[model samples]
Target chain A: MTSPLQQKLKINGSSVVTANRTWDGIVVYRTAAKGWSADLAEAAIVRTPDEAKALLAEAVADDVGAIGPYIAPVQVDDTGKILPGNLREQIRRDGVTIDLPV
Target chain B: MYAYDEIDRTLVNERVSEFRDQVKRRLSGELTEDEFKMLRLQNGVYLQLHAYMFRVAIPYGTLASNQLRQLAHVARKYDRGYGHFTTRQNIQFNWIKLSDLPDALADLAEVGIHAMQTSGNNMRNVTSDQWAGVAPGEIEDPRIWSELIRQHTTLHPEFSFLPRKFKIAITASDHDRAAIKVHDIGLRLIKNEKGETGFEVLVGGGLGRTPFIGKTIKHFVHGRDLLSYIEAILRVYNQYGRRDNIYKARIKILVHELGIEKFSREVEEEWQQIRHSSLQIDDEVIEDIRSRFIYPSYEKLPHMPDELRQAAADPDFEAWRKNSVAAHKNPGYAIVTISLKPIGAPPGDATAEQMDALADLADKYSFGEIRVGHEQNLALPHVAKRDLPALWKALDKLGLATPNVNLITDIIACPGLDYCSLANARSIPIAQELTRRFANHELANLIGRLHINISGCINACGHHHVGHIGILGVEKNGEEVYQITIGGRADESAALGNLIGPGVKFHEVADVIEDIVEAYLALRERPDELFVDTVKRLGVEPFKERVYATR
Candidate 1:
């Protein structure tokens, strides 16, 4: 059985492009300014499948700094704020919710 | 511990430089991810779910206090404040940066530690009985042989890129503490009728998607020809082992397909040509290695100390002493297993402060020596019996004195979906929940010796295959489910667990285990019979019936 992550990729959703920085392996989101940012709040929001695909393509084109570019589902609140739409993405954005020693 | 010679130091430093260059090339995109993956893996750097995970080998499960302190330094300096020790007797840092791995490797080399062969399709760090030299029933120290194998397998040219990863375990005692039967090659040190030391070699035992107990390939192989015999087995495996299917590539599969009789004949034929070659180690070489592991200077003392007798009066100290201490070979000393599976904490994880504290305790109590057991606990092998109360208090201060060794709460779990990319579900949380459920010391003591092992996936890193009560996590319809197994044993009579019925949902797992234990409590013939013994005697039917019964 395939895992949720291994299922067919769907571009049709409110999404933000994400990838890991090549050297440091930190998760980064495609920002509205056409660059990668560590903060998900600064991520460029895409409402349509086409917009998600375009942002993912742009992230892929900027491969010099990142790897494994994919579009992750995010919620756009009434205030136009972005938050992870699922638990997995929330974990990726906020680095292991379990309490860990510093 | 074998002190690093000039040659070892030079080779380690050279490896650090090479890895640094490889990382630099990878960052510059001169090497693609596919090309760099093998290089990084060989150096024990794995790209996990969130970040790069760095693993360092604790060769033969032996470490000096200073070396452990150095590891703590790396944990605090290069990673988060804690590190997770793995079932392979290696420690891993979850959050490692690719850019800092070279420096980390360099720092590790400074303490005579290395990541080489910790991963990749090479012979991994040769493991042995954790109490190799100190165990009472030992015929010979297995660490010497493990060390010899480590030297031979390190960067071995011919076997470097085999069909799959190979693991070899050696044990000198009759008790199978090293889990030799489940390894690719299980070497048991034995003696012949002539009183000559030799090895009883078993081949092709492994746990993964397919679990099989190893079969005896050779009744005995003399110590001098051990390496050549092993090399022969590897040669036979490399030539015929499947490379097309990664699942069928392990030597265990090859032996299973070829049959042990035919496999033994083939290895015997191959060994005839190489038996007298330079690979045959001499008695002097063995003695040299053995000489390096001489016993630490122990002051002569009476067998029983008055302080220990007085301390045994306290129930808490007595409980801790009974569960944590083991009989050492020396009359006045004991082997103390420091449990890493604290209540509510992740199994096998030690904070940097805890690591430093243990190091201090090792120096004060043991002879500055620490051993990492396959069960994910650290051991001070040379602690004087008189110092038990002091050691217990010190351990209590560091939160390491959990007298739950071999109990239900002492779980062996892999870093599952939370960290490992290969995991289908989470293992740590399951272990945590079970530990929390059985947190009461008296309740756990009532349950008695129960090994509850959990694996995140079929890879079986948590050794669920051999647990008395095994929990394997699986993904079902995008949800986490757990499969339970019963009657598995990793001892002299090693056997794989029998699967109970369907997988249980995450929430129902702890309750299911509680039900099974409750049934055991009702069905057991005597208080002395262990959980594994009861399951073995009565079979999995009773437990299966109870587990799958209606609510």
Candidate 2:
């Protein structure tokens, strides 16, 4: 069985546009409503390469809200939920997995 | 510790205001990401995987109690509830927001601390002997000179934009507590036959993709000529160091390409032209430098009081005192090393409450001063011998008395993929796993003085190249694996570790370490031989053979 991190790394066609929010450096995704959201569920998923490029371009033009916008490979689950495609992105999405001091 | 003067105060305050304006411009879409990155980096801000990591200097690992409380305040106000102490002895806030940075800098500056040149390609915070003024068999305090270098290097106009980041480490003792040999420029204070304090200078040493033990260029530099000589070396590096290749741009590469003898000649030539100029330090300047520093007042008590022996009656206190306490130059005092590595917590992390508690304890017992060791541990360098029992009980309550200094579980690891953006795999989890696997105190005591360091990439931020047992994280195919090295040490005789064999899976790291430990126990010449010594007596092949054959 593959590790959870390895499983996340195996992308199957789905992608999304993501960036860090400009004010606080929080990870945010380009939403289908032409805005940004911290939740991956509200992200605008693009399966085709051209669609990913267009979505990335739209995110880049909205640089006033975020920084370093780029297209990232994502994975679609059986329940139609979007998951981050790699461990780095997954970490950015869910925060640090380990227990940090409060 | 050196207090900030008027000029220093102005510069820091100006930088804070400048950063506020730049941050405003960035939010308003006036400055692009590329344009604002260098500015933020100069102020010790870097974007990590989760958020912006703001690094603040401890200035040669020395901190006052109130200064430490200010760090705790920053931790509570601007960052998460904790801060990570880095291998360089600086503190890093891993979850700071960009919007809160200007206020954070201003607040930190009020306590005479700023993050200037903490992250940029400028001379970084100078690291020195943690037991600088108090250690036995020491010359003059190294902090006086470390502070001098710190003053000279902060926003130095000529040396600001060097080829790459430079690090300097200094020591005043024969024993290498500062690991000076692994630095870009290592300064060792030695007394001549005439009994004058001078420096033995070593140049061009570094770690990362390339690691070199610093080569001594000058046998002795007079106290007054120290700054002149250092400036000459930096001038030569600024003129000749490679700029086209970022990977090969450090002074180590330049020194390697030029050969040490030729590099020495160039530095000498530069020194001759500028030695007597305004950069030269006179006796008055040295006196001024000495006057700027604050020294602890020793009470002049007898060595090893009866209360110390009485306190040692408990076996648990005995264990902690043996591992965590060291002899002080002054009698009736001991340097107490507080272990930041609790069994399951991150290696160098301290929560805000813990920081506040430790700072107050430091004020009450350790003369209101604390020193951060390069090994990611904190030290109360001037604790009275009489206070051992009380200090130990307090520390035990705080969960900082782990009795694992220099033991197997006291691991040195970088933030890696958890916080750093440049890591290939996660290193903290590997360190955590190893720490948990070796949680047995008896087993840890038996397998003593093993330095296990982990880095996620070739950057060697964890100083893995010099660890007795080094682990480097890399991704194979899609999953993470770790490469192990044996026999490396960072000391007066610093040497890089050699790779043992192929990379191992993350779950297999603990087993691999245990096998190596068992093999060393079986193969060592005597029970007292260090693991590095055993690996040296017999090369990596013996340990390699045992590990691979067993697996």
Candidate 3:
């Protein structure tokens, strides 16, 4: 069972922004898609390489009016400098662009 | 006496600009009150009930004459002609306006002072022994490590927002003058088996609603790796510490819940990852910082002057000598404590004129060196014993010659509901009433050595919990109630006080205290029976019965 903080971290968009990083949790991605609020059932948690690819695909699909490709990870090193590891950079390279409804 | 070089100057200048921009943006309503609140707090700006307060850091409680003068100028110009020295070895100007904060920071920067990390969850002002360099028993100056901590923690990106606010205190001497046991991180410099000095570090100690004496986490942390070790501890705290509940957020709670062995092992594990990194003490950097704290060359002098000998023979000087003077490292010199606790005046308060006079006297008698202790008292740490009479005469004219150093009337009280936003009752008026209650010097001397610390709230701003006779002011319904605790101590054997039944009404508090003191007088073990010893022998039962006879 996940706590509200964990559930909140699981959702990339909606009111819950990325809180902090954990060693083995899904890195959240905020969606630009309108009318798409994160329900607990819809939240993603990836553990495998296939699941990671699926998460990136879902995030790109949800970027209808692509506001950002901001990767929100839970943890970082002691320097407070953000780390973009291989997985994160691979996701960033597959960024999508979407036009917003005026 | 640490002097700022180019890096220090540049950092302070950049911070000034950042604060200036923050102020402009705040005033323009570009940021919300909450956002700006955190920002201002990060810079040590507190909005009290009446007005904004600017708490400036007096690092390790040492101040040059020029810094003292600059603080005085700020009091005269920015504040309402006075600043309050706090328990953390910081000075606070209570009446600063929101708009004037930038100007105040600029003025402070001119004297190499700032409010940075004086508040917030980051490392607060690194405090050490106020009598750091001059104390006779000091192995080495703790101010060196204090400065190193100050530099290492300043704007450290990783540790800015931790579980709760972190406080570090250092003591170079065997005596715990810095109150090391009650701080978050307490370091005592000790000579190890290798005949080299290093720090014995204690962690997880603080006093508020929940007080815990710090535990020794590390038996010996060498002079190097101080920064990285601290960083590792902070990172562990930041990552796993409770953020949902503010009360359980302090590292003490973590240490308590996880057990010290586990907590310490975790910290050690984290420290192993970053042990000898760039965060370790760079020799060049240490040398650069250490060079600033080197003592100024003093002229060699004889053991004692004839004038000092004659004054020591005088009766009045004899009394002052017994009370106000401390042993000096330099012969023919003494540390003079100018008691702010006058017969009728508020303790720890010096009017603007009094501050100026003290600054002048510092320049005249004490080799321009001044130190403000955690007890809100000022010390001229290097006064020539021969100039005692001259110094006494000058101080007498300024109304600062109270001759009540550590006496019963030297009450430590907080700025209560009158100024503080978190206060439940007024502390200054109670302190004043008690001062007038015990007006006679003979009576005060008769009571012997008793420390009465009164706090308006449970925040322990006045450090009431550690007083020999602690009074905590709480609000019952709409009226103020005073709770009395006996046998509390803040000395080498510091202990939390035991509560004496329920609290007394505000009007009857003075009378109740008088009754308690009377109880002490009647239960005389002897004339030399200090309050703590009596309380220790008889326990708090006698005082409790006297205080709450009708309850």
Candidate 1 C-alpha lDDT tens digits along B1-551: 77767888999999999999999998998987667889999999887768889999999999999999999999999898899988889999999899999998899899889998789888999998889899997998899999999889999987789999999999999999999999999999999999998999999999999999999998899999999999999999999999889999999999999999999999999999999999999999998888877579988876799979989899999889989999988889999999999998889999999999999999899989999999999999998989999999999988999999999999999988788768888888888889999999999999899999999999999999999999999988767899999999887889999998899998899999999999999999998789999998899999999988874
In angstroms, give how far residue B135 of model 1 lies from its true place.
0.3
Find the candidate with the highest DockQ and give its number: 2
Taking the candidates in order, what DockQ does each have? Answer: 0.44, 0.55, 0.01
The lDDT for every candidate, in the order shown, is: 0.90, 0.89, 0.75
Pairs that collide, model 3: A20-A74, A21-A74, A21-A75
DockQ of 2: 0.55
Best by TM-score: 2
Q: After superposing the true interface residues, what Cα RMSD does each candidate give? A: 1.9, 1.2, 25.2
TM-score of chain B of each: 0.99, 0.98, 0.96
- A-chain TM-score per prediction? 0.83, 0.84, 0.28
Q: Which ranges of candidate 1 are over 4 A from the true structure?
A: A1-17, A30-34, A40-63, A70-90
lDDT of 2 by residue, B496-532 (tens): 9999999999789889998899898899887789899
lDDT of 3 at B198: 81
TM-score of chain A of 2: 0.84
Q: Count the backbone clashes (under 3 Å) in each candidate.
A: 0, 0, 3
- Name model 2 segments beyond 4 Å from true: A1-12
Which residue pairs collide, candidate 1?
A: none
